[model samples]
Target: MITLLSVYVDLALGVVLAFLLLSLLVSGVNEAFVRLLAIRSKFLWAFLRDTLDGSDAQGRSWLPAGVRDVFAALPFARDPRPPHSDQPAPAEAATVPAQETKAQDAVTNLLYQRVREIDHPTRGRTSIANLPPGRFAGAVLEMAAAEEGGVDGLLAKLKSMGSPLHGHLKGVWESAQRDLDRFRQGVESWFDGEMHRLSMLYKRYVKWVLAALGLVVTLLFTMDGLEYGKTLLRDNAFRASVTAVTEAGPDAYDELRARCERSDPVPCITETLSQPALVKVFDHAIVSVSVPAEGDPAVHWNGAAWWDRLTTPSHWPGYLLTYVALMFGAPFWWDVLRRITGIRSRHHG
Candidate 1:
């Protein structure tokens, strides 16, 4: 019974541990994917810039001389930018004349002016204003140079091309960043909530698992007691005693009947023997017959009947101790093992 209980409890504990581990792994994976999604665009931009040697437009272009060609040639390069919808029409740009570039710049300027007219106050505020003038101007010149001209000529021409469209682009970028921050904050809060819920569920599951294990142990202990009782009753001495009594039953009854009929002969023998007080006398008689000659007086009595002899106080302590040990010992050992192995305690309440 003890072995069965231990095996059952161990199996239950293993199941609970497996469940907790699986939950933790799933939670970890979910968190990782959420975090990855949160910064996917930013990381993508950085990767494209580092590997493709191109600006956003160039990186997204689908033309022969675009980032695709550069990335294809540089085997080490990896493009990570999110796919864009309005990449430059590099095929059209390649066909334009040198003189037409100035006209295209003028048209671009006109478009920006129209956009400013439409947006009014929200137009000019840009991240560029937060940058050093030298760096900001250099960035504008580099963008223009990537179009067609050499760096020096691009810088000279940009002075006459009105302010660049960086201000509008910066505004959009900042707005996107703000939205991303809000999204990340929400994701973090959700993760925290999920973690808390998982913790509570884990605790609940552990409690139920432990409770089941305890029940199993209790059942095993009860079974052990029953087995012990069976063994005791099956012992050679006990079986022999029962057999002898059964075989001598008729003679014993006749003897008892004759004794009951005697007068003065055991004064009111039938009445006295039939009374409850006679039980102790019978118990004494049985005890005297059962024990060894040199045995302790406490080991047996001299006047007990079968029932009284079995219920003697002298033998009761051992039975009580065995019963108590069977009922409580397995759980005690299980608890000790759990503690030694650093297993968490289950909370019932």
Candidate 2:
């Protein structure tokens, strides 16, 4: 019974640790993808365009539209309009030209400025990354209140602006009916709900992208789920080492990565991973490994044969199984590993 329990504990620890590491690898690749493509900025821009321009919120992103023309003016978000549409124009319509007097509209200009900085490099810019509901609501209230009639002026402006915001404000205006505070509260709630939905949509997008990246990486590593599990279970020394590392907490990774980075003298892929130092100097890497004519079974994807990599039948099951494990994500595995380790500690203590 004691031996059985110990084996089970080791197995759980090994399995969870493997999954967590794999998930982290996928996330690392995804982070690279995001930076390379500017995915976060694109998503943030999409959300702002939905809110300000009143575009199809779900279909286009979390954003809006005449107000629709705002996306065109944004440097990062290029709406399918004329070249002149890239200039600041009145949010009232999509066709407003650069020469239009509506360019002087204070509210429209402010909103445009704010939306452009939705995700920015500089400070003092309106960042949607961690924008709170109160902040957005307050900005809206401030913009409206700054106008000639205060909130009433803002309401009139939104109504004249003629976008989905007009209807949204109208609903709040009636709902609040008499109290200004209620109107403010209603706007905050509305902003909160929209942000929540935006977050969900972004997560959905991230999930799909991560899965694609994870699959590619799994094949590259030849990470067979069944094979990995069997080896981990059978090798007591490997299991013990993994379990020890798992209990040591998040710092283990930082330490391991740091050590790997420093100790790695060779800038070779077939030699080292987490190649922080090499990537800094070189644009890319080219690592070669020995393989026979029949192809080395040990080598991942069999010596860079794209055709074999894509069409290999035996590799498919391993790739699928491991990829499925990775999709659960690092956070899930981290928590599981932590909890299981805690139980073991308590039992042993």
Question: lDDT of each structure?
Answer: 0.35, 0.56
**True-vs-predicted CA distance for residue 63, candidate 1, Å:** 53
Q: State which candidate has the highest TM-score.
A: 2
Task: Write the residue-wise lDDT of candidate 2 on 236-259 in tens digits.
Answer: 543344355579765445534443
Clashes of each: 12, 12
- lDDT per residue, candidate 1, 1-349, as tens digits? 9745654555444333322332333344434633433222223223223222223334342111333333242222433322332332232222112232321333232222222222212122211101122332333333443556443333334334332333333343354463534433443444345345534543443344344343333232221223333333333233343344478765444433444455553344334334322122223333332322356545454342444534556645533433344333334545655664577787999
Location of the lowest summed lDDT over 10 successive residues in candidate 1: 122-131
| C-alpha TM-scores of all predictions | 0.17, 0.61
- The numbered model that scores best in lDDT is 2
Cα distance off (Å), candidate 1, residue 119: 48
For candidate 1, the per-residue lDDT at 313 reads 61
Candidate 1 TM-score to native: 0.17
